[model samples]
Target: MESNSSNPYKDCLVNEERRLIDERTNVGTVEKKKIAIHMAQSNSDNHTKELDLGTKTPKPIQPILSAYPCTGLGKDRRCFQPQWYKSFTWIEYSITRNAIFCFPCRNFPTQPQKGYLFVIGYQKFRKVKEFLTAHGETNGHATNVILWNHFKQSLIEGTIKEKFVALTKSEIMPPGNAHYCSPPLQNQMLSAAGNIILKYIASEIREAGYFDVMADDTRDVSSYEQFCICVRYVDKTNTPKEFFISFEKVVDLNAESLTKTLISTLNNNSINAICVAQAYDGASVMKGHLSGVQEKYRKNHKMAIYAHCYAHKLNLVLISACKYLPQSRKTNIGENRASWRNFCQNHHSSENNDHIRSYKIPIDTLNIYL
Candidate 1:
């Protein structure tokens, strides 16, 4: 018999496998269609039932519980509860007892007597009313005024003077070693505290071996000149730490004035120089060649070097670019002349309507002069 070179059995097996796969694929398609039809029928039935009942499906309910623990206060004062629950409990108690009073007189006893009027002055009453009005706590200014006046009259005659005496005593002998003083007096205390903090910061800086200084001035809403001085140094952990050593009030912001202010503030706080590096705003008075703050400091301290502020350099560059460049023209001579003309025209315009004007220049033109 001749040797069978072709694999007939293998070819037959491959044909059978292809046929089985096609049959299985058709079966899967049919099963999916049946499942889709069944789902549609079920949904239709549910919709019909809802229509007949004339009721919408109820939404899944969400829990209205909080994550924080709820607790009750006992005779022991040390027991703590969730902050929200405690606040709610106090509010409920106040409402039930009718103990809630205007913020200014909340601590006073209920049904204030005739002599209690002296404790709260007319100015304070007015201030409280104003505060309430500003904060939208009460409506009708006239009603607030009437209620405040009635409450005022209920106070005792000598109570105001007594309260003042109590306040003075509190200041002189604050409870628990904490300070108690009026805001103005508190400001004076803060100034003294700031001086102490500065001394501590300076001492820390000195111990650190060497440091750089960053100084700047800014105006507040009231246009008060405030100067900020900080020491930049790397701590033992090799991390950069900037300690704001002082915030001094300055009379003027000129270069000489600022330099004088800086020296005076540092000297008062006992911050001695050790290879000083001054960083300031790029204003002429601060960074200028002649009589600038850095120049003034250089005269006094030979080791003082002005660190050129990158931000200031960028700002100066942008300002110069805008001033010398004209609309649509970038060539230095043409742009400058155009800008000058536009500025002159805008300055002379009667209605200041020059903003609506535009200059024409070729878009394809490129000038290296700029």
Candidate 2:
């Protein structure tokens, strides 16, 4: 068989034709079976090669399986360094003497070294260990306990006290301006801040000579009984300022109780007695003639009047008009007729009967002649 160069499909067919001829000549009737087996083996090899190219090999990662040490000298102990030793030389000296001289050095320590241990007692020693641990230094707990005990012993012995002394004047003030003393002044400032709001309210009331006070009782979010006393007044420049003077938790709101609270609050603030006017809603308890707050004040100050609330009076008038104008009448003609009949019935009695008879006789004579 000859291959065709111009067409690729014809060329492949020619190659197959040559292969079949070769197989037939070499193996006779068994040639087709051998060729099929060879082609199957080649396809299997190509498939395996493709799979190998697509497969991935995993890499190993470092493991963190190490446990903390059982013994005192662990990794944390190896990295431990006492931070307090860096600042004070006495600490370094004590450590060196403890390591070298042992018991002899403790019996014959220098004056300054004993004094330093006395001031930094057990409490301070424990605090220093905490400070080291907070800054990433570990394994100082046991050593801190030992040092703290030693320092506490040094405080008990007088050998540590005679080493150093300081003379402090009575009422020694801090350096710089007096305002710079923040520790004590901080408390003062806190108290002043509390009073600032109340003082401001008083100043506002003082500037506004006359004010109307509104008093009411209400419960707060915390379920505490509280009295809300608000002041409405105009300032010197005629600008109105309305603010709460008192919103405080109270035990009771009885007449005596409320009056006592009012007197105390007014007197404490140096407020004039006549400058304040009280206004409240038409509550029976507040305006009752005998036992109400209005009556109580009227006993002392007769001018203490109870003005009828205009809004309530207007409501009464509207109700009366609606009751008289039933059936949605444009004009109350029925009401007028009823009013005229009642007037005539009341006026036409024994004295008015003679006047009515004379007027009727003239009317009758005129009617006959006509």
Candidate 3:
């Protein structure tokens, strides 16, 4: 390990630092250096960079007045102490500048809204509360606070993925490059996270010993035959719990294919234990005697009892009754009128019905004269 003091390239580094060009030095050179720094910090391949915690918290607030050593004048020529400076979480007193700075605001730079508490030091003690209030209410400061709080919560929850996303969005990407974090990419990340959580829950269900499955298939908006699987089990609290496990797209809707898909899902999740029960809607493909999903599954696990869901049975009954029942529908105009009157009598005021009936009654010459 060569000492930096004795290194041969030490002068080259010092000269390089002096030669560094900025707006005050030369044209186009400072911009290039900044771009280099940004690129080095950026995650071009969808990877999260390591979090710089020092940048998030910045200068820690302390209570010792002597350590900060304020020198500015106060009422009656006394050394000033910032009234709003109570060693609050967001407050930090700068010893070099002899002024107060917002810790969270300086830690995460955003567009300043008011007097230069964040950029320039805030020293006006008389208006300290007013200035502090204004700085705290700024859009940029509020946003930073929310992001910082969310990051802290994620750390507490032990959610590394969420913490990574929060840190990347807040710190890694350069300011004003919001489009770099595309919506589609975010959705994909969320979906991946959901799959991980779902698998863990499925594992929990498998460990619960006895569970039942409820399955159903429907055509999604994209015209794909999507199968949904859910498991019901008694949880640790002795309460019945039901959780959705999977939504899979199937190429075929036959009894055999459906049964195979179900079996494959269960096996993949290591849920091969004997099923306590199974429930599905009454379709020939699902509930048939010899070749249906229930039959096939039952053959493999005899303890897995199959039942045609009673809810589906009731729905089918209602549809059949509407289709075949004669009294449920109007056969003629007179019958329709009678049905309307019957409905009004049952659902509306009987007094109003009687008044309507009285008006309908045939009034002779006496009523006409009156």
Top candidate on lDDT is: 3
Better of 1 and 3 by lDDT: 3
lDDT by residue for model 2 (165-195), tens: 2122334544443443356666775556657
TM-score of 3: 0.41
Compared with the true structure, all predictions reach lDDT values of: 0.49, 0.44, 0.61
Clashing pairs in 2: none
Model 3 lDDT tens row, 199-308: 77677676777888889999998999999988788766678888887888999999989999898887876665558899999788898878889999888778888887
Model 3, C-alpha of 50: deviation from truth (Å): 49
Model 1: residues with Cα > 4 Å off, grouped in runs: 1-181, 310-370
Ranking by TM-score: 3, 1, 2
Better of 1 and 3 by TM-score: 3
CA shift at 270, candidate 3, in angstroms? 3.6
Candidate 3, number of clashes: 0
After superposition on all CA atoms, how large is the RMSD of candidate 2? 38.2
Alpha-carbon runs more than 4 Å astray in model 3:
1-181, 321-370
- TM-score head-to-head 1 vs 2, winner: 1
RMSD of each: 30.9, 38.2, 21.5
Candidate 1 per-residue lDDT, tens place, 203-307, comes to 876677666777888887788888987777765667777778767788887888888888887677666747467788767888886889898887877777887
